[model samples]
Target: FPQRYAHSLFVLRYRTLALKELQVASRKGARNLCSVLVKTIAEQVWAMEHPQYTESRKEPVDGSMVGIQMGKTKVFLRSRAFQQLESLRNAKMIDAAILVQSRMRVFIARSIYICVCSSI
Candidate 1:
């Protein structure tokens, strides 16, 4: 197919024409592609700017007052937030109805319940 690159390695000879075709394809649906890529980038940016989309940030360890302390980023990323969310999803704890609730309320209620339940 013309759509496929002649070679996966993309040699220089093919690079020019390949780039030209990509440019043509990109131009044909630049708006759509831009919208998609822009959406992806926006989501990534949002995730980067606020890593707590699925959950809120928990209390961070204070380095000055602790025997051992970890940076917020380390704690945030390593937090059980994702795993807990995955389990909630697997357990079907919240279907579509609960998903529409106010973000803060939902998070607070769900997190408290999860924390209490997990402790047992």
Candidate 2:
């Protein structure tokens, strides 16, 4: 199924990134950092692969939801933590939040459109 394929790609991409980070940590002689990063990455990948299903589950699950306007097709303002992480990840090289937000908006919109079309 398309969902399964998408999930696989997501896992692959993250796994590749994690491996690269691990290598960097090792080269920097930060054994503790490498160990912690690998553990966290493994946990995240497992969580994504085996999502919990429960009747008590509510909409807009924490950490998983990325807000975007449906009609206007824009990203809702991100939290402070997200902004900080984005900046940190980019090494302050450029403030590309607008570009990233636009991409997120388009991706979210396209996903919604696909789900709507598929269910019809």
93-119 per-residue lDDT for model 1 (tens digits):
355446656676878999999999999
For model 2, how does the per-residue alpha-carbon lDDT over 1-120 read when each residue is reduced to its tens digit? 111112223333233435556555555543344333434443443344346743344442332232211112112223542343344345433445767888999999999999999999
- CA RMSD of each candidate after superposition: 21.1, 20.6
RMSD of 1: 21.1
For all candidates in order, the CA lDDT equals: 0.36, 0.41
Estimate the TM-score of every prediction: 0.23, 0.25
lDDT for model 2, please: 0.41
